[model samples]
Target chain A: MIRARRYQDARAQARSNPELAWWVFMRVSGVVLIFLVLGHIYMTFLLTSELQASYSVVVNQLAQPVWKIYDWLMLTLAMLHGVNGARYSIDDYVQKVSRRVWTKTLVYGLAALIYVLGTMGLFIISKAMLAG
Target chain B: MYRAREGQWAFALHRISGLLILLYLLIHVVSISLVLFGANAFTVLHDIYGFWLFRVGLIAVTGGVLYHGFNGLRVAIMDFTGWGTAVQRQLWYGVLAISLIGLLITAWVVVPRILAGH
Candidate 1:
């Protein structure tokens, strides 16, 4: 009975705070990112020699549509996950609301810029490969 | 703020590691984007990453990623499931243990290879 009540209370608390949703997102995304990132590291670093990781190797890999999607997913998830985490820190450390708002605006702007650029890079590379 | 317990330390470390991973992601995205510039730009960047210092940096990144990834799982279990909250502390310790052991194994396998520049 007590355990159930405690669980209910925790759930209630989470529901009450909007920020808790982001917290949940962090956990969920973190789990997914673990698989994505570890796989990426294994494939990029461990699967090949230094020679194999050369520009040509990367170009070849990006030439494949599947690899492009895989990388795009990795970039998108990582940006959202990390940016939300940083926003949490900003909320915690910055006492003033106005300051927090400004900081978050800056953070979000930068994240958007990076995400756009990354997407463009992936698309451009795919097009270049297809053309050549 | 200065005095902290095990859980607090864990939280702090998670935050730091999370931030580091994010920073690295930013750099990784920009660098990989260089592929669009053609072969020479991409290969030049790859050559820089092949240096010993960057290889050493990879160890730190690997460690950070392991801890954050495992700890994030623990946090997720606690948040999304009923049973996990009951043993949250134990789960955290489990995360730390796994991270340490996993990192040790990774370093053992990777460090030598990186050092020898294969």
Candidate 2:
């Protein structure tokens, strides 16, 4: 966790290249995700209630390449961003080295599994739509 | 416990909401991915989520997203600008105000739908 008050300070504190990269990645990804995620929530939940989004409606949307790409972008970016943020927290609070490694392994494993699952889901829906 | 002034509270809330959102994201990916099983599988899960309990939980999720996003921007501002650190307290209040307004607007749109049981 780069606990610097300024970008220069963050750069100064960064112990390695990857550390600096992640510090920059958080800010960049965060700004992008703010728009992507909030727009997703607005469109999917607020603009239209989830109750109205039945299975067929979901299929219809996902069948489109556009919505597929949109969702996949959100899924990929949000997962990476969220996972990295979680890693920071884990580094902070999880003190014991062995326990921290185990915890991080579990989190990263789960995140990778879900990312693949979500990508498969997005593509599979289009195929299902075509076959039906 | 140390005295948690504005910055401490902001940091703590950011961590909590970030973790909560990550937990939700894990479940969300899995649940949505059930669509691959077929419409029946998808609809079954969807209906379960349509329960009022889950719907209300989503409203809280919206609130969490707003706060986390806005506070994130505030953090970025503080990191990039010198003056941002000087007025971090004010920026934190602004973050709260924006989050509250967004939550209220979301509730206004969603509460009625939840009430009608649609």
Candidate 3:
């Protein structure tokens, strides 16, 4: 069958793995982050600053437990997103098996560590703020 | 089974992390909206955020924010830039190294300050 022949070709000649997935994602997400990040910057950096932003102001804003949960989650997501995004781009550029493994291992491991710490920190702070 | 290498791992992780960020951003927006909407909500956030546990969380979250935000810029550049082509391979590692170093430095100062405050 033509399909079978094409499949064989992919298996025999496609190096180690099909990278079409990551390639596709970087594109789709690159477009999204442009808006998410830009709006984020504009809102927090630009607008927040002019409107009497301060520690107290932040505290005032964070008054809701929902916001605390929101921040904790955002912290986790942002770390994972950025790290992964970088990895996607990096993999396309770097092909050395040894280096890539160690590098990605390090990136992911560190990111995981950061997420744990951040979650705990946020939880502790929120509890304190709520209870205090 | 063919073992996937480091590059592959990084690639997989990147996509997973991206999805995570989308969720996190959603939560953040909803939470902040509480404060924007009224004084009562703002008071609750202010009190909870000041707690020792919350302060620690703030530091960790800040680290994530810096890393994600900065590293994103790195990715965008590597994908789009001429320099990325010339130094292409080295760029990602270079960005990763700088990010780690930058995070460490920022944490050193910020973490200690938070600790001192507590």
Candidate 4:
């Protein structure tokens, strides 16, 4: 984790090109996710009631291509962003190289699984499937 | 343990909130994914969610997301801008204020509904 207050510091402190790239990705993805996620909360939790998230409502929303793409974007972006952030935490607190590696492997594996599950759920829903 | 001031508090809160939100997201994805199993499987959520504990937990999740998102914006601003570092303390306050407002708004809107059992 590059703990720099400015972009120049981050660039200079980066051990490798990919580390610097991830430093940049965190900011970029963080900005985009702020809007996407806040809007999602606003629509789902603020504007609409939780009761509206009933099975039929969720199925109908997923059936639409627009919501499917929007949710997929959120799932992918948020998962990557959150996983990377957690990796930084793991690096900071976890001592012992062996423990760190195992922790990271588990974290990455779980993130991948959740990402695939979320993506599949978003795409696999349709009225016919629900009926059948 | 090191004694922390505003910046440390900000960093600590950001990390805790970020990890908690990620945990919630994993569970959320799995629960929502149950739709693939058919209505019978999905409807199980109605009973679980109707539980008061889960309903209240959603409010906490909302607050956590708000703080993480706003503090994240503060970090981005500090990263890319020259003046952002100078005013980071103020920016941290702004993040907290905004998050509080969001939490209040969410609770206001959702609390009654939860009470009414909707």
- Report the number of the highest-lDDT candidate: 2
Top-down TM-score ranking: 4, 2, 1, 3
Q: What is the fnat score of candidate 3?
A: 0.04
Q: Tens digit of lDDT per residue, candidate 4, span A29-122?
A: 8889889988998898889887778888889889999999998998988898899989999999999999999999999999999889889889
Q: Point out where model 4 deviates above 4 Å.
A: B1-3
The weakest ten consecutive residues by lDDT in model 1 chain A span A1-10
Candidate 1 deviant stretches above 4 angstroms: A1-11, A14-21, A49-51, A96-99, A127-132, B1-3
* Higher-ranked by lDDT: 2 or 4: 2
DockQ of every predicted complex? 0.54, 0.84, 0.06, 0.83
Clashes of each: 0, 0, 21, 0
Question: TM-score, each model?
Answer: 0.85, 0.96, 0.44, 0.96
Scoring model 3 with DockQ, what do you get? 0.06
Docking class of 3: incorrect
Q: Residue-wise lDDT of candidate 3 within A1-132, one digit each (tens)? A: 011112333245444454433343444455555445545544553343312334345554455577567666456545544665657555766689898888789767766765665465444443234334
CAPRI-style docking class of model 4 based on DockQ? high
lDDT per residue as tens, model 1, B1-118:
5877666777899989988888888888888888877777877888888787887777788888988998878766765677877787898888889888877876786778876877
> What are the clashing pairs of model 1?
none
lDDT of 2 by residue, B1-118 (tens): 8677999999999999999999999999898888788778888889899888899899899999999999999999999887988999999999999989999998999999999997
Better of 3 and 4 by DockQ: 4
Scored by DockQ, the top model is 2
The whole-model C-alpha lDDT of candidate 3 against the native structure comes to: 0.51
